[model samples]
Target: MTEAVQIRPEQFPLTRECPFSPPKEYRDLREEAPIARVNLLDGKWAWALTRHEDVRTMLSDPRFSADRSNPDFPQMVMGRVQDDDAEKSLISMDAPEHGPARRAVLGEFTVRRMEALRPRIQEIVDERIDAMLAGPRPVDLVRELSLPVPSLVICELLGVPYSDHEFFQAHTATMVSRQSSVPDRRAAFQAVQTYLGDLILLKEKDPSEDDLLGRQIIKGREEGTYRHRALVAMAFLLLLAGHETTANMISLSTVALLENPDQLALVKADPARTLPAVEELLRYFTIVDTVTARVATEDVPLGGVTIRAGEGVLGLGFAANRDPEAFADPDDLDIERGARHHVAFGFGPHQCLGQNLARMELQIVIDTLFRRIPDLALAEPVGKLAFKDEAAIYGMYSLPVTW
Candidate 1:
């Protein structure tokens, strides 16, 4: 057999020369070796799928398991292995278990349910903007606007007390941060888990039908389906994902819109275009790039390569979003692109559970922010901004802005 070409693995995350664009090397990977092997932070090798179709296919295939507890599963970041007894959130499970777990609380995030939340989401956006307007010049939008809006919304939805927002938000930040040591991440995980576990017990004892967790608790009891551990696991996943992803997107999207004047003008001119604009923003700024890594349970044909059983695959969603085959001028921030098909939310059955709610929240926040502050602009040069370069989830750490 002809010796397979040997290409030294480029480090995972392939550092970005520009914050708004993927690393320039991705273009080469897509054209030359779409299924190239890459070295992760831990100096481990895994197949990194860069093409859109390949990523979607891998995500949809049942053979590629999402169970992180699998020792062979790829670890993109250098950290401790996941706890075996840890709550098996939907993001970390495969079929059969994943489907039922997802369906239980799926009703809470449907398009209809999210649509019902539009008015409240708008109110939350407006209220935050009100505070921003009242504050002094050159406010940090991340603190005043981006962080609180979605945090408050998810808190209200899950019936977690909004007053305790700071508690969970701090722990979540540690959990997602790349700079956090393994012990720090573990501590953060346990802290939130303990908090949610206690909250679930409370909800079970005294259920509130209106809240998402309360409803789940009541339903679990009525159906005798979910045990205490399952309910706690569900709450942990929702609370962490609920706020962090959307909050980062809010901060990052604001920066994207401000930087692209022409594109920003389009959304400002037509209010109806905001929905598509939100989708395009999600595509362009795929913040959660590291979320989708899976281990193959069986030998799988993927990206013209046979991923043997027990091998790991990292579906680079950020890279896929920028694939030329999937998008024309993929790097451009075209608010009109309507790139809803992008895998920014991951593809297949394990796609983001709260995407519908995320869409509504982003639409309302983006539209209302610009409408209320028509002159909104970055307070400093974009080059001077401090991005979350050390974080697994990409976003600006602090977006300073003025109107």
Candidate 2:
């Protein structure tokens, strides 16, 4: 039997040192050896699950656990910066713990809830559009729309004051950025924790009748199943995950659409085309490259390779979404790919709880942007557009555009 190829941990730090997109070497490795050992930041090794089927199987397998409390678990970017207890939110929980915590906020992200927010999202979209049009000929969409829309929506949902957005947004960017220093990353995590801690207290004293934070506080307290730290952590996860990923998706999708005028025109000609187009774009972009880190609970053979107990597994979502085996002509942007299955929002027990809300925001933004500014075009060269290179969430710093 051929010995398994080992990828040294020092070679791949989660920082800007790693390529934003999977490099040619990764593609080659995926094909040659689906399960390869790769070095992580701290000189520790991790099993990189590269193939589409292998990633899907690993994500769904009970042996792969998301719990970060395990002492042997490799420290991913955020885990390295924050305390273990603090990282115990939904993304880090396994099975039974992950389920109820996720369930606590699932209803608020349902299609029904998102559908009700459609008109409000539309209004937000129009307001942003109007502001953009009223600006100089060219404006940065990342600044004007992509970032603000979701931030504002999530703010309202969590009942967080918009005044505090700058502080949180800065922290959010630092926490997600690959180039951020260890001190900056730790500070960012603490900033978010402090902000959420205060918000929880505020909610307890004067609850908003219907917001998600308020609702969670009520449910948590009523069930007598809540801890102060847990409530803060959960709220932090919701606010950050709720907007940050969707914001990146919106920016990335807009960039993709603008790059493909034919598809953009197709969606522009008929607003109804936005939904399907968004799905295809989500699959094509697959902006969230990796899911939360998972650890091997026991010895598990994945894709003919044996993973020993207590190894870390990183699910390369970007690779899986673009796998030719799963997606036909995966490189081509087909706006109308019927019933596409992409792991953009992740999969299984840990799938994104706010997916419906994300889709609703994307749909409304896309439909309204094209309708309001039919002549929108990229203000800068596509290649010149600066992207957040080192972040777990792939996004642009500024998406300049003009109508």
Candidate 3:
């Protein structure tokens, strides 16, 4: 038997030098070491999967466990212990448990449900844009448009009051930030969990069938399948994820389009082009790259490399979306490319549940923004804009714009 070699690997997740692009080192890694070992934040090492094919296969396979409670699970940072709330999150569960948990709430995010909510989403977009136009020139788009649209939508869906968005948004920012200390992250997690627990208790007293969380609560009580504690954790995950990820994408996608005028014109000329434009943007700005870490349950050879049982692997979604093997001229932002196969929202059973809603929201926002204000442009140079470099989710902290 070949003795497994142990060595300190190159640091993983090299800082994204370009705000809108993946790290240059990722391209080099994809070419030379598609499945190479690399160092993580906590001094531990794991195999980093850089190719789209390998990442898709690995994520779909049952051998790789998504359970955070697993002792052998590979962590992005060290010494971070998951609390009970973290353990019950659907994103952190494997099959059997993951399947039923996901199914229970899956109906809420279906295409029909999202379509029914489309008019409201459009209204919210217009309302925000109206306020932006009325108030001032060179407004911070992040605050004015990007954040509130989805934040309001998600709040309504989850039955959480949108007036308290600041509280949970602050907590979520700390939770996903790489620079946040372990204690800070834990505190953020607890704060959101407690808030959701309180809200769910109120819903239990007066459940509404129309609302997502209320529906889940009623079903959970009748079926006895979903526990109150588990529901709180689930709500916490949805509320944070429901707003943060889509909000960042909105800001990042807007900046990308503004920078590429020719592409922006395409979306502006024909409203029908907006859908594919959104998909291309999703592929190009594959933001949530680091969240899909998994631990191998058995020996698996991938991309000519063997990932041993008990080993850790990161499915680098940004690199995979940009892989030349998956899309022709992956670096270029082509609105017509229709790169729907991209892993921006991930793949397999763990694919984003709210993707349909996200897609519709982006399409409406982009189309409406450009149509209403054709002269819209960045207030400052793209390089000068503040970006969330230290956060796992790639996006701008603030986007100042004028029309």
- The clash count of every prediction, one per candidate, is 0, 5, 0
Residue pairs clashing in model 3 are none
lDDT of 1: 0.85
Per-model CA lDDT versus the true structure? 0.85, 0.78, 0.85
Of candidate 3, the 10-residue stretch with the lowest lDDT total is: 1-10
lDDT of 3 at 306: 76
Candidate 1: segments with Cα more than 4 A from true spot: 1-10
Candidate 2 accuracy as lDDT: 0.78
Query: Candidate 1, 226: how far from true, in Å?
Result: 2.7
**Residue runs of model 2 more than 4 Å from their true location after superposition:** 1-3, 8-21
Off by over 4 Å in 3: 1-10, 84-87
Tens-digit lDDT string for candidate 3 (246-336): 9998999999999999999888889999999999999998889867789988998777777789988889999999999999999899989
174 Cα displacement, candidate 1 (Å) = 0.9
lDDT of 2 by residue, 71-125 (tens): 7676656346777555487788887777787787788888888888888888888
Superposed Cα deviation of residue 372, candidate 3 (Å): 1.0
